[model samples]
Target: MTRPQLTYRSWATALAALVTAAATALIGPAAPAQAAAVTFTNPLAEQRADPHVYRHTDGYYYLTATVPEYDRIVLRRATTLQGLATATERVIWRRHGSGEMGAHIWAPEIHFIDGRWYVYFAAGRTEDIWAIRPYVLESSAANPLDGPWVERGQLQPARSSFSLDATTFVHNGVRYLAWAEYAGSNSNIYLARAVNPWTYTGTPALIATPTYAWETRGYRVNEGPAVLIRNGRVFMTYSASATDASYAVGLLTAAAGSDLLNPASWSKRATPVLASDGRTGQWGPGHNSFTVAEDGSDVIVYHSRNYERYLGNGYDPLSDPNRRTRIQRVYWNADGTPNFGVPVPDGLTPVRLRSHDLPDRYLRHWEFRARLEPNVTNLADSQFRIVAGLSNASAISLESTNYPGYYLRHRNHQVWVERSDGSALFRQDATFTRRAGLADATKVSLESVNFPGQYVRHRDGLLYLEAVPDAAGRASATFALD
Candidate 1:
């Protein structure tokens, strides 16, 4: 015990321990790993309606939408989704002078089919502008922007009556086309199998109609069908009501392997998946297309008017040029269905906080009380902006996205999103110092600035400021800013 033998292994172990301790002492505790912030400005592009963002395998995002002029099919490509905002738009194909494809060029969705590029769009004649029909344009060029788009004529469904907003997808070795067509006096979504990009092989089946009260607002309408296949299910989102502020998004779902041409295969939701959020000043948020983000996360690309009123080109909502293109991340429910959430405000996008220990749960506010919940139906309740502290500039605060002026403040040790009464106590209660996660340094922990040793932790599904003195308590305090 007085004199230990200097073995090579023992000496190396002692030396390694001394080096680690010295390094730790020199730098204090290891700095926490900072997560890369993923954000994009709202209104991705101005005056772009029925926006479709397609991420190609060639590492480019191709964007095509309804131009305000309704005169041409324009295409823009960028490497990043955010870059699409400033990306140069090229009019790949223009309307015909007077015949078919002459007027009302709308909802141009770009898709790469087989080996050629295809643009499925709706157009009308100059003499009869209301005679809108879905059409297809093909290109042999590698880049659709630099295209010699050959008009493939109309993509004739089985019952093509004033058809528009056509979208195509292939599943189980079969390609199917989904579009909104006028059925009876109302516009309904129809589905059919496609032999080629321009032709349907079988009879088109009516999948969704404007029957619910939300679907029948200004008009008995259901149009703008967009297809997204995920989680063993085929999701079809279509726009309802008129093109005014009453326009919203409804969803129809079918089993992936089921007979898509059969009307019985699809089930429609009673309510819309996405609608206008007056709190965020977004109106008529409809005509959406889905795409994957750079990080391989699902993103919804849609058009919305920031203002509720239409003041451009008479009373027609379509005449208003302010229905700008926007995009946001799509969250998923426990059942694998998508939660589009509310149309977020026009600024930096908000983020969700996922519980570290309970991965399925998120920090959400219900009736103004902060708690952890899974599969939150109200998507806005789960979203928040991590901003500078209301009281201390050096700290941080969680601001509710839906309630602009409210923040997550600890009142009597319980967290709630309360309107700031402009009191010093309110600000102090809302402020929290961002610390390295007590359980996992890579994650984050919010410590109460007012109550130094207490941390914002989850207990019994509710959030509270409590002392994280144990491993379980530390785990509850940690959160992933997703």
Candidate 2:
């Protein structure tokens, strides 16, 4: 497996200090420290949509997305999420010349189940290309990349009408299939118990209908269902409306133990959970799939147009050019619902909050216990979102990615996770001024805006706010944002 390499550089004088620290680490019971990653840009890959990034248990990330031509399925694999950008892509399957899987292929999802691989995708016939239906392709190879896929034929729900976006999940040892189908006038999300990877049993139950204003804009549609099971709940998010700027993501959730086939057991959020953020220039963000970051944090993979305007011919939105693949970290709400933050700006370089003294350690909180631990194997907890403070837009506050809605606020000179109340002290304590480090121009040092001279640093494996010291102290406070 190939992983992204991180390079570390330090001042010649600090090299001796680091060498001494390394020698001490060698003699101790602790493992060698890993270098922190300093940079990665957004729009992970370009000109791809309806992305399904699956992080296999074997330590490789498999990404499959619909090419702009809508003619075939492409697969790419990388050891790191960012590495997927340059990972070699291969077209695994293409549309048949004049048969059922003939034209307008869309939304391909690759899944490994029951020791075999299967791809669930939507396709239409050349005779009636608009009459799209869901189909499956099966591969016998242990590795999906090494596949000579066999056609498992079309998956027909009882009605045999317009159906697409078929997704499968296992709950309580029973496999279930959820997808969008024509419920008379418009498309709506439906659910049915699946007998295996490629087929469903029993009748399909309608779970979500486009009734809200957000769902009905431009067109009444509910498609592209992606399921995420966490915190004793089953969360399923689906795309809605026309495939334009009005497109958005709506959510339906049910308890983990609930009878998934019963539509009454699920509840839909009143509003769209993820939508276009005009401020960020990411329009029509939907058709999202979830994967975990290398650090074990939840990552949301989806497609969005960089520009709002559609460049396609007046008739079909699929001809639009800008629906590129993008990914960002997913945070959980204080109430346990997944929080899909607004689609971030393109070319984004995300940073993790690290301590100056403990160069190998970053801030992480578990059960509200914030501490500094070197080489945190669970890297997601160590990451914090540095956003403008609630009370003061000019000042920045650090929010824990693992524990959402909790900001690092200092009370009595001790930093801890506190509910961001937008208060004067909360803002002041949480607010930090980021400046270039004195030791390295590219490195960063964060100083407390409220405490003035006191900088966030570590001493004896614990973090503290102390008055600035000499050159070595300043060097200890510098951190590289990855």
Best by TM-score: 1
TM-score each candidate. 0.87, 0.71
- For each of the candidates, give the backbone clash count: 0, 3
Residue 388, model 2: Cα distance from true site in angstroms? 18
For model 2 the local lDDT of residue 336 reads 77
lDDT of 2 by residue, 1-482 (tens): 12321122124224434433432332222222222332234577667899998887778889998887889998989898877776778989999899688998999998888877889899999898987888999998877888999988788543378888988888888888888998777899998888777778888889889889999877899999999999999999999998888889999999998888888988999898888877567889999899887656788899998877542457456777558888887756546788775776664334465665555676666556567776564545566666665555655667765455677777777667777785687878887776666456556666789888877665555556777578767865676554
Question: Weakest 10 consecutive residues, lDDT, candidate 2?
Answer: 1-10
Best by lDDT: 1
Model 1 agreement with the true structure over 96-142: per-residue lDDT tens digits:
99887899999999999999999999988899998899999999999
Tell me the lDDT of candidate 1.
0.84
Steric clash count of candidate 2: 3
Clashing pairs in 2: 38-482, 356-476, 356-477
Candidate 1, pairs of clashing residues: none
